[model samples]
Target: MKVSCSVVVFALVFHFFLVTGSRSPPPSDSVIIIGAGMSGIMAAKTLEEAGYKDYIILEADSRIGGRVHKGQVDGNTVEMGANWLFSGGPKSSPAHEIAKKIKLRTLYSDYGNLSSNIYKQGGGLYEKHVVESAFKVADARQEFGTNLSKILSSKKGGDDDISILGSQRLFKQVPKGPLDLAVDYFYNDFEEAEPTRISSLKNTFPRQLMEDFGEDSYFVADPRGFETVVHYIANQFLSHNNNKITDPRLQLKKTVRKINQSKNKVIITTEDGSVYHANYVIVTVSVGVLQSDLIGFVPRLPHLENELPGENMIFVTVTDEESRRIEQQSEKKTKAEIMQQPFGRIYFAGEHTNSTYLGYVDGAYFSGTFRSPSDSLYPLLGRAT
Candidate 1:
């Protein structure tokens, strides 16, 4: 499918507004960004930079940094969500720019170490030959699949209802044996969800981008925590505006029960009988939360059509002393990385999303955001089921 240029424009405009703080609250329009995760905060910052001051962030949880949760364990800090800085190239990766702009320290990840312990189920532990053979095979398969996608796109109308796997089989030759398994592993590493559910064409885009513009790098701040970064960003925003960052714009502990949206206004009702209204509302809650139908919408969302169901991204942190010791020793080798699986609007973004640096402080910094088409304030008017 063709990418939407309007979404790209919106993202760019939003980013600009965040960085420049040029937006002012509209006289009749107000915005409410749900969740305080990296994406939500980024969205809020974008609005703030754009001079839009009449916006509030509503967080379901008591704390900010939705998926980028962090805490201390045995004197070492652990991240519950997003970590790693895929790359720190002076240009391209926005995360890198944000890190530098916010004065956050980062470190380069060591993927070439070739010292990973192979965990086998029955064959026991063996010194696998660097698995370079598998990687090579996977690479070739990926290239072939990419070329095949192009060919399919070029072909005249054949069948619009063909499955993605069917298209791959029609256009590209599949790699066999270890190569196929390796390709599967590589794809898994990138997607973080499931391989069978992803489209070969769609998967290749981010993989290609990461190969070119991304770096497998992560950061370890002096204090070794992800909250520092969040605190830094919040502080900077507040400092620039001379406003108190602790202002309760977010209605924490007040779960949103229903949303009522119209062409002119959007109203949100909490389970506690409280109501909030705004012109624009950015729902930053997790796909898991959305799928649970915890929050009801009035008119319902149509962009959700053909969207994949929620593939919950779990974050498990092993913060024992022994684990921490092992972590430090493998610090250079262990870095936050992302699994490149696609599951539609339910984008995965967390530190554990990667394997090498599962629970590192940097992992919490690596999670990303996603937006849906019908995500505007026009879907919350009807009654709940």
Candidate 2:
């Protein structure tokens, strides 16, 4: 999966105001949705169900289904992005509901399953305690989340200024044994996608310390593609008949480049110079792409600390060749509130926005459905705060 940033804006279009709770009634003005990925498609589906038909989905890629991507190894199915379904709690997630409806086969990769095979980095089988100890590292994990929560609870906090913590810090205490090394290697490797350094731990904690797998996640290794759920969603609107879906509402290869809002209309300029006019627009792209300035907002979006790349260039920047270190960054920065909030008439949705599930497919879904109207927050697409 590629990471890119995007910007969505709401146009005033005169002194008119529309507010229904946080949502307003559907109007004839067409809605332009950028990206055909999970959040984008899901957003479109919601609009379609609400008797709103004047909306169009503009996707940058030739295909839809953004992070819910599947890969092939010798023709065998493999997940390229977001490989698992995490249950938020007792509540049946949309992914679970869809899986049950479609009878999608899923394999449970519980703690026992993961802890069973412990492979060392260089050679030899690593001992089990190291793996077990990784799960028991609650003290270290507790050192990170909201500083206020910690202070209120009288809990000692980690460094305040730091926003991330590299798992390498934990490695310093453990013995340099193969088993210990393996555990450290596996965790640090995976956490490379997320910087271990922490400024506020209220938002996240060490994954191993939490007994959350059963309550939150399941691996999808079915014979069918992992993205089958995305297919089911597309079928809801895009699919005409059982197979052929030729909905003109869904336009592919339309990469949004700029957004300029007038009093009533929002003008969207695509990379190909194709101009689209709409009464409202919903931009759903990645945090990275949004930061990369792939799509420009008329009044300009907030200032981001870094410039991220599209799928084509993520790896080059994420890796640290000199120290052989993978410089993982925490997805949502400290100042994500600025990233999320509604621009003018545009709304934003993506996994980066939902702090409840944060980084999970559920976050993507939550942001897509939860942020109905005027509730335009782009969190990761920014935290709702």
**Which digits, one per residue and each the tens of the lDDT, describe model 2 over residues 1-385?**
1121122222111111122112346445578888887778887886675456788888988777888888789988888886766555545567777876888877665645555587666766546665777645523443433333344334332223223243234334532576644454444434335323422233443331122422445678876766778778889877566644589888989999998988788999998999999987887787667766788888764333222332111212233462243223223221233344456666666765554445566556656665422233322112311
Query: Local distance difference test, per candidate?
Result: 0.48, 0.57
Candidate 2 ranges with C-alpha deviation above 4 Å? 1-26, 113-116, 129-135, 138-181, 184-192, 198-200, 206-216, 304-340, 371-385
What digit string (tens of lDDT, one per residue) describes model 1 on residues 212-321? 33556665454445555665665655442343356656556767777777766778888888898886676656545665678887765433332344422223245689
In terms of lDDT, which candidate is strongest? 2
Determine the C-alpha RMSD for candidate 1 after optimal superposition of all C-alphas: 15.2
The best candidate in terms of TM-score: 2
Span of 10 residues, lowest total lDDT, candidate 1: 1-10
lDDT (Cα) of model 1: 0.48
